[model samples]
Each structure stands twice: as C-alpha cells, then as structure tokens.
Target: MFPIRDHNPSGRTPFVTYALIAINMLVFLGYWGQFSAPGLDQFFYTWGLVPEQILSGRGGLTLITHMFLHGGWMHLLGNMLFLWIFGDNMEDAFGHLRYLGFYILCGLAAAALQIAGDPTSNGPMVGASGAIAGVLGGYLLLFPRAKVDVLLIFIVFFRIFAIQAWIVLGIWFGLQLMNGLGATQDGVAYLAHVGGFVAGAVLTFPALMRRGGVQFWRQTHGQPPHPQAKYRLAPSHIPRVPRK
Candidate 1:
C-alpha cells in the first residue's frame, strides 16, 4: 500500500513543489527517447553515480546533477509519485525559495553520506529519490499527526484509510534502512535516503520551533490547513453474459 494523497495541505502557496514536478517531468521526457537497457546502463554508469569518480574528486558534481536523472520509466514514475504526494505541503511550509534550497541541501547531504559509506566504489548514483526523501522528512516534522491516506489492496479487496503521517513516513524510513542494509551495492542508495531524511528533519526544526513548537499541534488541532479530499467511486457497470 502507498499514499495516494494527504488530507493536510500547507497554508501557503506551493509553487516550488509544482515547479519541481514540472521540471522533473520535463527533464525525463527530454531524455526518455534514449531509454534502452544497455544505453541506460551506460547512462546511469556515466551520470547516475560512480563511487570511484566521487572519491577521486572527479565528476563529483554529478552528485547533484544525477539527482535529476532517472534510469527508467518505473524509476522516474515512483520518484515523481512520491514527490507529488509529499512535496506540496513542504513547499507550502517553507515557501518557494527555502523549500528549493532545502531540496538541494538534502540532495547534497544524501550524496555526502553515500560517499562516506563507500568511498572506494565506482557505481553511479542517480534519481531524485534523495531529495524527495527530504520532502517526506520535512512532511513528517510539520505534520506528524496529519492525516495521510493510504491505499490497501487485498486480493480483490480495495480500501483506503487515513493514518497518521508519522506512521507512514516512519515505516517508509524503516524500509529504506532495511533495504539499505540488505543490498546497498545493488544501487538503491539507501544511504542517500537515510541521509536526506535526516537532513530534512533537522532543517525543519527551526520552522517547527517558530510555529510555537509542540504547542502548534494543540492550536491546529492536529489537522491540515485545508479540508480533506472527498473521493467518490463511480458506479460500477458490469455487463451480464448468457450462454446457451
């Protein structure tokens, strides 16, 4: 199950988040025509992340540039989905400038941790997962108790529930850690995820404090600024068949 959307939205404008989505989509489409298995492998190797290059201080700038690249459709789709889910609220809270800065910083911090973990490897790391992880991080801080909708599919059963942001984000983080430990060499960059999450959380501390700290929860009643979305299921239409 994953988040389709959140019930809570920020009180301010979220232009940065919208702009980010647009940029990532545009960039992906720009390079999508070259998505071949072997070609992508080479592209990711050259632009994704190469530990040897980073450690040697050559092509180190790729740490930042790589965040904007994707290996394939699923990679890009998943990252963009998460960004769409959690980014707007963070941008609302931090505004365009600060949110944008926060995003880049998280990406940098993510790269820093990955490099620190394996300074001798030569694998290229890419994708916006790190920065998007930061968005999830910031979301946890600003809306720990906010309502997050998650879709659950069991066999033919489908359902959705509004759970606390803490639970969803916390579980997501734990999964990353578990995956990171199991097979970081496989190119998931769990280190980057952990690093970005930590950075986003720490970075949002000041803003949380400024909002009257824990007291803000009491004031906002643990709800988002806007109303929850009302999802309507269209009437099901199933045609009957008869056999002679």
Candidate 2:
C-alpha cells in the first residue's frame, strides 16, 4: 500500500515543488523518443552519474543534474508525486530557497554514497528518487506523527485506510535500508535512499532546533496546519438479502 494523499496541506503555495514537478515532466518528455535501450544507455552515460568521471574531477555537477533526469514515465511520475506530496510543508518550514538547496545537496550526498558503494560500476544512475528520499527524511523528522493518507489496496479483497505519515514513510525507509543491505548490486541504489534520508535529517537540524527542539513536535503535535481530508469509498452494487 502507498499513500495517495495527505491530511496536512501547506499554509503557502509550494511553488518550488510544482516547478520541480513540471521541470522533471518536461525533461522526461523531451527524451521520451530516445527511450530505446541503446540510446537510453548513452543518454544516461553522458548525463548520469559516473563515478569515474566524478573521481577524475569532471562532470561533478551530474550528481545534481541527474536528479532532474528520469529513466521512464513511471519513474518521473513516481518521484514527482512523492515530491509534491511532502515537499510543500518542508519547503514551508525551510523556505523555498533553502529547501531547494537541501534537496540538491541531499541528492549530491546520495550520488556520493552510491559512487563510494560502487565506484567502478558503469551503471548510470538517474532520477530524483534519492532527493525525494531526502524529502521523506525531512518529513519523517519534522512530522513523525502527522497524518498521511495511504491507499491500502488488497486486490479486491481489503479496503483503504488512511494512516499516519510515520507509518507510510517509515516503512518505505525501512525497506530501502533493508534492501540496500540485502542487494547492493541490484541497480536500485537503496543506499542512496538511506544516504539522502540521513542527509535530510541532519541538514534539517537548524530549523528543527530553532523551533524549540523536541518541543516543536509537542507544539505542532504531528499535524499539518490544514483541515484533515475525509475518505470516501466507491459505490458498490452488491445486493442485500434483508439480513439473511
């Protein structure tokens, strides 16, 4: 199950989040026609993170640039969705410019870890998953108890239930760390997730401490400054047998 929405809405417009989403979409579309395996490989090799290129003191900016690139439509969509969902509040907390810096730096840290994890591998790493993972990290630290709307689908068996952000993101992070350990060379770079997450948490310290340290959670009590969303179920056509 994954989250479809959230209860906490941002007090101000998430301009950076929207812009990032649009930019990612446009970039992905710009290269959609070049999705052939060979072309895609070349594209990533040129723009994606190359430990050799980085270690050689060249193409260092790719760690940040690659955050804007994506592997496919689904990859772009998934990253943008998560960024949109949690970015606003964090951006609000850190302000637009600072939030942007945090995001990029976390992505940079993510690439660094991946490179250190496998410096010789020629695989080209792309996508904002690592950076968005950073956002998840910030959200977890800032709003551990906040309510997040998660859709629990059970293949036409179970129902959907809105759970807390802690649960949703926490489970995701746990999986990332676990998978990072269990499968490092599987090409997913779960280590990036772990790295980005740690970076978000560490970097967000100033803001969190400024807001009265641990008391910030006590003050906000793990809720966004918006009204909670109500969930509605789809209409079913099952017939009732008069309680038989």
lDDT of each: 0.82, 0.82
123 Cα displacement, candidate 1 (Å): 1.2
TM-score on alpha carbons, each prediction: 0.87, 0.89
Q: How accurate is candidate 1 locally (lDDT)?
A: 0.82
**How does candidate 2 fare on TM-score?**
0.89
Tens digits of per-residue lDDT, candidate 2, 53-97, equal 888788777877788998778778788889988999899889889
Q: What is the C-alpha RMSD of each candidate to the true structure, in Å?
A: 6.0, 3.7
Q: State in Å the error of residue 231, model 2.
A: 5.8
Q: Write the per-residue lDDT of candidate 1 for residues 178-231, one digit (tens) a residue.
A: 887676556588988999999999999898899988898788765664675555
Q: Which stretches of candidate 2 lie over 4 Å from their true place?
A: 225-244
Clashes of 2: 0
Backbone N/Cα/C clashes per model: 8, 0
In angstroms, the error of model 2 at 87 is 0.7
Indicate the residue-level lDDT of 23 in model 2. 90
lDDT of 2: 0.82
